[model samples]
Target: MTKVDFYLLTSHQPQIRERFACKLTEKAYRLGHRVHIQVEDQSQAQKMDDLLWTFRQGSFVPHALMDTEGAAETPVLIGYEGEPGAGMELLINLCREVPQFFSHFPRVAEIIDQDENNRHAGRQRYRDYRDQGCSLETHQLSI
Candidate 1:
């Protein structure tokens, strides 16, 4: 069974995003699950690298999204930079979209802003996953 979680970011601080990513990585690691993250650009990917190193060592995992070009198979698909993919145990959304990507992953989570506009988008994604028979949880993080 897959689980879904959504977190609302209180601020747009870079540290906050990194912190959440760390938490996400730790969660995945503790569960003994492999992770594949997708980002919009090299910069965001770099940011994730910094945070992920605390949990993972050695050469960074291949840029699966870039290398796979949405063709490869994965247990988790993250939509940060471009089109989001499903078929993952967990999907983490780092942006403020409606999270169409959640439909693909069995477990989906989004880090969204506290503002009304972004808040609804993240919550809607959570509900969509839940409606699809996924366990969903939401968190609010301070900046």
Candidate 2:
């Protein structure tokens, strides 16, 4: 069984989301877990990359622009492209659509409830995934 975590955040700021995702990824990495992130936009993806570089100066996190070509085999797969399949353990999803890529992973963490529709959708997703026997943990952020 895989551990899944969900967070309801009050802040709509891009920095807050980026920071939270990075922090979570760092924690996961420290615990010997692989981290996978998918940002909504190119700008957000760049911000995440920048944050990663800043956190570990000169260190590189594997990044590939999502498109029809698909993502190469790697630990951290960013962008909206590529098929979500085996080998993915931990996932940090920022996209509103909730890509089908994360379906196989039992452990999926995300920040939801940024808006009205999202609030409802997020809650529904939580319930649906939980009903499927996925271990779910939700945290509300002060942001």
Candidate 3:
């Protein structure tokens, strides 16, 4: 069964999700996990790709866009649609809705903001995962 972790943020700041995602992906990479970040669209994926490079001072994460060459060999991959390449261990989902392919991965991370829209969507995703009988957990993030 897939393990879904919902990270609920206390701050409602815009774009916080992406920033946190960068940090999360970076940590996962450092731990030697292949991470694939799924966003709403290509533009969001581009934003994530850029943020991963400069989200913090002197941060370096080896990553590539999902559609790019040799993405399967990269430690992290960002994509807007479709399934990720082979050997993907963790998935960081930034989309409003749960991806249809969520259960395929061993672990799925959902980042949620405090705003009404995000909270509502997060609840829906939680319910969806619960219905599927997957192992679900929620954490409150101070940031």
Considering every candidate listed, which one attains the maximal lDDT? 3
Using TM-score, give the best candidate's number: 3
Whichever of 2 and 3 has more TM-score, that candidate is 3
Model 3 scores what on Cα lDDT?
0.90
Q: Which stretches of candidate 3 lie over 4 Å from their true place?
A: none
Quick one: how many clashes does candidate 3 have?
Answer: 0
Error of 1 at 89 (Å): 2.0
Q: State each model's CA lDDT, in order.
A: 0.56, 0.69, 0.90
lDDT of 2 by residue, 1-143 (tens): 55667888888775566677777776776676666787777787777777876655555555444442545555565665565556767888877655565666767887774777767777777776676677778898877
Ranking by lDDT: 3, 2, 1
TM-score of each: 0.57, 0.70, 0.96
Off by over 4 Å in 1: 1-3, 9-13, 54-87, 98-100, 113-136, 141-143
In candidate 2, the residue pairs with backbone N, CA or C atoms under 3 Å apart (3 or more residues apart, or in different chains) clash, namely 66-81
